[model samples]
Target: MNTQNAEMDVESLQKRRRGCFLDAFLVGSVMFLFAAVTTLAVVGVMTVKDVESRLKPPSWTSESGPLKLTDVSSSAVFTNFAYLEATTSGLKNATMQWAVQQTSVGHNFQYDRTNHWMMPVQSGNYFMYVNLNFTCTHICPSGDFTIHVGEGVVDKLSCKVHLPKLQDSTAVIKKCWTVSSVASKQKLISHMTVPKEGLDNWSLDMGLGMFLVD
Candidate 1:
């Protein structure tokens, strides 16, 4: 009976030793896996930082920074006028004419057409267009029609349309100008031109249009 007890005790000791070894192996494997994951995470962060440092402007940045420029702040406004009667007789060169009426569509914009000079009140980029149509007694000589815009006498922008030789019919002149970097307080005015003979019949459809852009 004493020998039998000794053998059972030896078997129990061997089983405990095997269990301890298995536990140690499992713990070591878990530790190694955790270390590898941590190293990979650190290397990935460093690589991203290095790539960001070498980047240049005009590219997207992931780091928290000022939002890139956008056109959301841009705005547009414009006003125009037209004449119902002939404002001038024998018109050959540039001249400013006031409108007796204003178009209802453009009154709410930035343009303030007190009379002939429908100038802009807000300062920004603006697109200005003018169309002057007329009638004549005889065939009118082909000439250039110009829309002159500026402060006082300095013509900053001029849009011109050529009138081919046509008489006893209709003559049309048009001009368009895209102005940039303008001051709000700067004095602005505009004028138009047509053939001398066509001036008497230049009574209808004489209109101007403008739009402001950011």
Candidate 2:
């Protein structure tokens, strides 16, 4: 009888041990599944963000447009000047306007019309840069412009402008003198003073210098 009782106790203990092991294995499997699910969720979110970025245009590109520079110089001593204009092409549903001023010097300036602008004219050469943002509601118009400057030594002026296109992050830099148009979007306009020596060599890619816009 004693032997029987002992055998029964041993069997019970063995059964309990097996049950514990099975429970532990089930818990481990559940934990592994949870971890896998979490990892997949994170990857999915990252993929969505990447897709969004790919769909959106870059800031520099989205904020630029067709750029033109007009040299208005008189045959006088240190009385040459220039102005810049940027227009939108194909961009629809946007209102576009821009203003430029010499950050270093003061001068009279105008936009959209003539005879209603003023700025303090300062000595020495200066750069008047403009930035524009707009949204059109009706028809998109081709970008066009004229830059005006007071009588001064209008040395060489360089323009660096970019316009962004939808579905791409990179901006298309309107090659200097090459005309570009946008029908509906924001555009960027930048003007800088060109060095006298660099202006002499128009063929070299100064990356930013004067070029004739035909």
Candidate 3:
């Protein structure tokens, strides 16, 4: 009877040990699965956030496009000159046009409606000239206008001019001036330096009488 009792006790103990071992294995597997799932979720969230940040503008920095320029015409008396510098990771050909703007004064110069000759194909500095006639009704103003570069408007000055004026006496006054007029016929040029990051192509579109696009 004693031996039988001892045998029964041993069997019970063995069964309990097996049950404990099985429970432990299940718990470990569940913990490992939970950890793996949590890690994957974290990684996924991070990737999504990174992509959203990249697409958001006014991007502190990134790539973008579809540049437009409008009716840019030159006058005989006051010529409008502009300089644009654009840099991009990816750039193709830039298209530009000159449009007509009805000014306070009547259009004195003949309007030549054609594609301006200064479109840039590659990455470098390009210069353009527009001859304008200035009607002395308003004082002739000349200076640099900021050219917007990139999808975001990054403004850089266009041209610098020294104007001669009549002072108090016979001596003519030579002064340096800057003007932001879209109506004058002036020389416009752009120097594009490629950016370090983002896409591969860069383009700049400067509408003579209007604003520039990049």
Candidate number achieving the greatest lDDT relative to the actual structure: 1
lDDT for 205 (candidate 1): 42
Report backbone clashes per prediction.
Answer: 1, 31, 36
Query: What's the TM-score of each model vs. the native?
Result: 0.44, 0.31, 0.30
Off by more than 4 A, model 1:
1-90, 104-115, 170-175, 193-204
TM-score of model 3 vs. true structure: 0.30
lDDT assessment of candidate 1: 0.52
Residue-by-residue lDDT tens digits, candidate 3, 1-214: 9999999999999999999999999999999999999999999999989854432211111243322222222232222223222122122224223333322111222333343323222223222221221122222222222222212232223322222232222221211122232223432333323223311211122222222221
Model 1: per-residue Cα lDDT over 172-199, one tens digit each: 5443445545556555566666665544
Single out the weakest 10-residue window by summed lDDT for candidate 1: 69-78
**Model 3 lDDT at residue 26:** 100
Question: Against the unseen true structure, what C-alpha lDDT does each candidate score?
Answer: 0.52, 0.33, 0.33
Model 3, position 126: C-alpha lDDT score: 22
Ranking by TM-score: 1, 2, 3
| Highest TM-score model number | 1
